[model samples]
Every structure is written in C-alpha cells, then in structure tokens.
Target chain A: MYAELTRRSAWHDVLPTVLGYIGIGVAFGIVSRAAGLSILVTLATSTFVYAGSAQFVLVTMLVEHSPLLSIVLSVFLVNARMMLMSTTLSTYFKQEPLWKNILLGTFLTDESFALGMNKLNYTDRKLNFTWFNTVNLASYLTWIVGTALGAMLGSLITDPTKFGFGFAVTAMFIGLLYLQIISDKTISLKLQLTIILFVLILTYFGMAFIPGNLLILVVTLLGCALGVILKHAHN
Target chain B: MPTIKFIFWTIFCTGLATWLTRITPFVLLKKFTLPPAVIEFLNFVPITIMAALWFQQIFIQQSGQLPAIDYLNLCASLPTVISAVISKNLLVIVVVGIISAAFFNIVL
Candidate 1:
C-alpha cells in the first residue's frame, strides 16, 4: 500500500533527533530497570508503551500497585492529547488506506508528529507514509538500542539517588510541561502559572489530610477547571 | 508490590490505551471534533498532572506531621525549573536536574 521510502531523504530530517532520542531512551531504560523492572519488561515498555513521560508515570504507578483501571486511564488521558496530532496527520494521510493510516498513527509520537508537520508546511519534499514511517523506524531502532544498553548498565546501579536520579520522574514532568508551554503558545503564561500555583498549594495542603489517589483526581479537576475558567474569562 | 503477571498486564493494557488514543482519532477526526472547552481542558491535563507529580516528588508525606520537603529534590528543582523556562527542552531540563541533584548530594 505504501511506496518504498528513500532512507537518505528520511534520515536527513531525522538525523538531528537521533542523539536526543537515544539519550532520553537510555535514561528511561535505566530508571525503569533500577526501579526493579526486568530487562525484558523494560524493553517491552520501550517498544510498546512508547511515550516517554507516560512510561515514567507507569513505572511509579505499577510499582505502587495502583488500581489497574486508574493506571490505564491516567495514561490514556495524558496521551489523549496525541489525538490532536493524529487528527492533523489524518488530513495528510487521507490518500492512503485506512489500515496504513492507522499503522502510521500507532507509531506517531510527539517528536515525529512535529517533524512531520514541519516537513509538510515548510519543505518541498513530499510527505508520505513511506517517509514518515521510515523516520519512525529509524528513531525506534536507536531508541531500542539505547534502552538495551541502559538496561544492561542498570543492573549495576540499583539505588539511583547517589547518581542523582532520586527525582527523575518529577524532573521529567517539569520538562514535559515546559515543552508543552513553548509548543502550544495558545495558552498564556499567566493562566498556566495560576493553574500551576493552585495545584502546587492544593497538593501540598491536601497531602496531610487527603489520600494520594484522591488528591490526584481532585487537583487535576480543579487545575483544569482553573485553566478553563481563566481562559474563558479572557475571551 | 505487584505480581509479575500484574505488571505485565498493566504494561500491556497501558500500551493499548495509549496507542488507541493516538490511532482512533485518525479514524474519528472526520466524524467528530472536540468542543473548544474540552480541547482546552485536555490541553491543561499535561500541565496540571505534571505540576501534581512534581509536588508529590519534592514533598515527603509524614503520618502526623505536615509534608516534609525533600531538600535534595527541592534544590535540584530550582535549576530544573529555570532550565525549563530558559531552554524549554525536555532533555536539557532532565540533564540539568540530574546534575544539580548529583552536585548537591555530593556537597551536602
């Protein structure tokens, strides 16, 4: 159904990101392994879970034995934003078969989506399933290699604190948030700050009294509410 | 701690749910468009949840006492947040955070 992709052309667009992908992929693998996941499991997670921040969230939730539904739901909700990417790409992929479009969607990620959109808008190169899928495949291979290397190294480094990994998940979240802020540009910094401040205070004060699980829901709702309220007020 | 079976299932299910989020929208985009308010809310989720997760990490919960601050994490977070503002890159933020954490732990 798809044309044969030129690796040279695809790699041209994907070259800059290969190092970044391998670096972060290594971190994810090491953190998951040091958290007590087996090498096989870590590899499975990198292969299937796919999303970076989502995998970090999974490591924490799974280790805590959080309710199964909650884990799936949280990941679903966090990643649901990717739907916007799929929607955008669907426009570009409409010429292809439904199965091929879905297959492309399965491999879509924040980086690849941005890359695809960037190519479509600015460049003369034809953006097609073949090119996009090749980009994804190259990145995926490097990511898997990085993960395997880290998993092997992780066996020697159990307690990550001494190596400064005690707050890796939290740091990852901050990075994720900041990255979103720059990319979307629709939401004002003022609104983001207001919601963040509210969540920070709410979580801190509620921690002494509220259960962690319940607190997560309450904060998420109120934070989202604050965002919507502030946004509408401006409009 | 969960059983190996439970972990596998969680991974498998999460993978499916995540993939579905990305895949179904391609098929559904023509038939449905999320309302502006819902889109706004969905956009805020990553922000709100990230803030919550960051808080959970930096604060240590005590049974009777109010939450205690994780000094090491707190120290590292300052630079990480700054890097977030200045760099706005995930890898940069993470690397800065890791370095700050390691530096402080060694000195203090």
Candidate 2:
C-alpha cells in the first residue's frame, strides 16, 4: 500500500478534504483553547481523539467541569456514526493486511469516508486501498497541523470570552445539527428527528437537580434509547 | 482545576471508545450482516446526541440551572442558524456564529 502512495496522488484526490479538515481543525483548536484547556491538552485531544465535533464537546465538558464518565460517553455517542461509515467503506477494501485495514479504520473521518466511498463507486471487484489511504493521510496531517496553528493563535488571546469564542462550540454544533436535519428530506423523518431532539433537550433541562455524575450519563443514554425506539416505530 | 490523571483518563477513554466504533465494524462484521433494527437504531444516535449537546450548551447555565433566556447566545444563534440553513457550509456557519456572538457581546 505504501509503495504507490505518492504525494501527488494523495493531494490530487484529496485537496478539498485537506482544505476542509484544516479549516475545521483550526476552529477546534481555537475553541478548545478558549474553553480553558491547556495547549498540551488541546494537542493531545486532537492528536489522540481526532474526532472534530466530539473534541469540541469534550472541551465544553472540561470547561464546565462535567464528570469524566459523562464527557467520555458524550464524545462516544457523538462519534458513534463512524461505525456505520467504517462498515460501509470496509465493504470495498481489497485483500490488504488486516492490520492495515484496522489502522486505516482509526483514521476514518466523515470527509475521508465520503471521499473513499465516492472513489469506491467506480470499482467492480478489486478496490484500490492505497489511493484511499493517501486521502486519509492527507486529511489527517492537515487536521493536526491546523489545530496546532489555531492553538498558537488562541494562546495570544488571553480573554477568549471577550471575542465570543466561548460560544464557538455551540455555534458549530448548531450548524452541524442543521445539516443533519436538512440532509434527511422526508416529512416523517423530520418529525421523528424533532421529537428526538425535543425529548433530549427536556431531559437535559429536567435533570439539573440530579447529582452531576449521573446527570449527563442518564440523559444521554435516555435520549439515545428514546431515539432508537422512535426509529423502530417509525420504520 | 482538573487533575492531570482525570484529564488523561477522559482523553484515553474517549479515544478508546471512538476507536472501538471505528474498528468493530471492520473486524467483527466483515462477513456478517447487521439486523435492520440495529442499523436503524445507530442511524438515530448522531442527531440525538448532537441535539442534547447543543441544547445543553445554549440553554444550561454554569450553575446547572436554566435561565429565563440566554439572550446573547440566543441572539447570536439566529445568524448561525440562518447561515447554516442558507449556505450549508461549515466554515461560513462558524464564522457567522463567532461574529454574531462577538457583535452582541459588544453592542449589548
């Protein structure tokens, strides 16, 4: 796989993803710093976790002093869709080493998965894993570098609240939520999504009196369970 | 302040869970087909989790209480929501959000 992964090949196919990841990664770094994470923690989270939206959520939880279990669970649930994405993309994998496939799975972001799937659409039986690996490599490197750049800039602004960077994560989440809703076009689907959202929001607001340790975990699990049941009934 | 150990554990756990999500399908389900119900259930998780997170951030205060109105955030969210609906670009939406929130903080 490594033999054919030329720099030219990776960049040619993944330019858009490279640019997109850099932009999002920079934003995550700035917000993570603004939320009071040390530069080291910011780098560690981005380098280790590599899930953009979940990183923002984790930063928010850290800022607010949410319990550790809650933070982990929330991030997990947010990134869980990777399971489906990875599964779909794995179907087209050629007979590469199992380790390579597993390693590649670790790098699977939404943008990478989309690009890989689009490329896979052209092949009949023998899929090209190296090209897709190049795409992942490009996206991954840009993301890490962009975050480092943003963290440096974020460090300069001592009072992040003054620039409203405190609200950056919320803004990002809203945008993502809007995209999720608009992507699904059926009236019934929209209705179900709305119901699920409403129930989750209510649980969050209603659970304020509970102990901190149980609040986030219970609400998150409850919300997910409700969503699953709702989908079962609707379909 | 959070201890180093707590933060480390949080990061490690999040990374582990995320890795599991990314790896399980490739390893365990390569030759298997997931039930329709299970797939449907997974489909709904993203939206629900995000909505919970969004509302929690916007509506819940630091003291674990809901305010009468988070006026600044609510006002800023108007632009964010509008740009997201119209442009559907992540960069644009984030820029609008940051600018709107900053503007409201300055003006009001």
Candidate 3:
C-alpha cells in the first residue's frame, strides 16, 4: 500500500527538485557563512526567506554594511518576479483552499514553481493542491538540510570559488532558461536578444542612479513592457 | 548596520516584497478580468525575465569592462551548450559545463 501510494504520487518529479534544491542551498549556506552571517541566521534565512538569489544578495550587502533601505530594496527587486510566479500559480491553484494557497505560496521558490508548472502541463491535470504541498515540503526539507550542512562546514572548506561552486546557481539558471526556451513555442531569438540588451544597458545605467535591488525592478519591469510592445507589433 | 538591525530590515523587506508583488495581481484580477492582450503579454514575462537575468549573469560585469570574449567561459560554455543541444539532458549539460569551466579556469 505504501509503495502503491508513493507510485501514485508525483515523487518522480520531486527527486530532481530535491537534488537541485540541496545543491543550490548548500552553495547559499556556504556563501552566507563566508559573508559573516552566523549559522543561526543562515538557517533562519533559508527557513523563512527561502529565496536563494535574494538571500545571496542580502548576505553580500550585509557584509558590506550597505544601508538598510538599500539592502531591503535589493532583495525586494530580485524577488519581484516571485509576484509573477505566484500569479501564474494562482490560475492553476484557484480552486484550492485559501489557507493552503497562502501557505504554499511562501514556499514557491523559482525551482519548485517551475517544476510544478511543468508537471501540471505534462499531466494535463488541473492544479492539485495536495501534489504541490508534497513537492514543496520535500524541496523545503532538502534545502534546510543542505543549508545547515553548508553553514556548519563553511569555514573548514577551502577554494569553493576555485571549484566554481558559486557558478552552480548560474548553471541552474542557465539550465532553467534552456528549458523555457525549448518548451515555449512563442519565444523568439530576436525577442530574447532585445530583453537581454535592454537589461544589460538598463543595469549599467541603473547602478549609477538607482540602488542595486531597485535597479533589478526597473530593468525587469522595463523588459516586460518592451517585450509586450514587441510581441504586440509582431502579431 | 548592526546584525540585529540588518536582520530586522531583511525580514521587513521580505514581507514587503512578498506582499507587493504576490498580492497585487490576485487582488487586481480577482474582481476584474484582464484583456486578452494583457494575458498574452503576461505569458511571455517569465521567459523574457529569466533570459535577461541569465544573459546578464553570463555576459555582464561590474568593473566597467565589457565582456570581451571570455575564453574560459566560452570554452566551458561551448561543451555545455553542445551537450544541451544534442543530449537535452539537464544534469549532463550542467556537469559538462561546470567541469569544463573549472578545468579551463585552472589550466588557462
């Protein structure tokens, strides 16, 4: 019965997610510790914030003793896309209970959300709130464990940078980007180039005028607007 | 900032970020239906935003220097991209990319 139940569940999708989360979470923990955050704080951030990129940026800023407002602003900007993520998820999860939605919403990191969405597409299943909760719980547990390990071993370890562990997050992002490009029929090379150029230029200028996090916000929103206009014109 | 102060600020910012972005669309769309054009636009937002971020990470730098043919990144990225194109396996491509990047970084 247990095996049957496990087989019926979407644990297959959950395995890759666990691996990805644990690897990335360990990297975040190491970076956070190296940035001078205590293990407690590292664990807390992973437990509460649960946003890897934002957490990394926050730690870097804290180490620099950046202004509080600036730190907050940067994190806010990096995670602004979470809004879009939650919104896309809501369409799938509308029929689920409000409390469940809110709870699951907090755990909706990029990787889990993307995995859940793709799974939904493949199964052609309506958003099953139970399945989402199971996937997220598994991911969250793995992340916390990985974070703890990284934090504990952070000081003892040497040359993580030499190993390009820092780039693991970037590699994950690249992998996710490749998946999106391949899966979506509507995405075009020209459109991709335009957004990339716009962000690079905007980021260059934004760093001068706006704070770091806010710069991400401005660039992202501007990219969204430009994409919309370009797509509209094309069609 | 003190550690405690920074922690508080981080939490506050997390709350603000969560509420502002996550709640806005639901509140706006719950009562009102967005136009088709807007929905279509929203569909592309994820891919475009992600692409912008990925490109920026790979190509851009903060030292006021242009990304002038990062041979190491290229060497690593070439095999990575090839694996991605041919095999289409996420794990394989990532392993190849990281190994190549690290090997090149150490050697050259």
lDDT of each: 0.74, 0.68, 0.66
| DockQ leaderboard ranking | 1, 2, 3
Alpha-carbon runs more than 4 Å astray in model 1: A1-38, A51-143, A165-185, A206-218, B1-14, B43-46, B61-66, B84-92
Who wins the DockQ comparison?
A: 1
Tens-place lDDT digits, model 1, residues A1-235: 1123466667876664565466567777888887788999999998988876678888888888799999988787667657655765676676678787888888887667655644543344247877888888887887888788878888775554676755554566676666555554557878888888999998888888875545665677788888988888989
Q: Candidate 2: TM of chain A?
A: 0.64
Worst 10 residues of 3 chain A by lDDT: A1-10
Q: Per-residue lDDT tens digits of candidate 2, residues A63-142?
A: 78899888988888777667666766665562566777887898887666644433332333234567767777778888
Question: Which residue pairs in model 2 clash with each other?
Answer: none
DockQ of 2: 0.42
Which candidate has the top score in lDDT? Answer: 1
In order, the interface RMSDs are 5.4, 5.6, 3.6
C-alpha lDDT of residue A162 in model 2: 61
Writing each residue's lDDT as its tens digit, candidate 1 over B1-108 gives: 688899889989999998888899777754566676666675566667667767877788876557998888888889989998998655577778778888988987
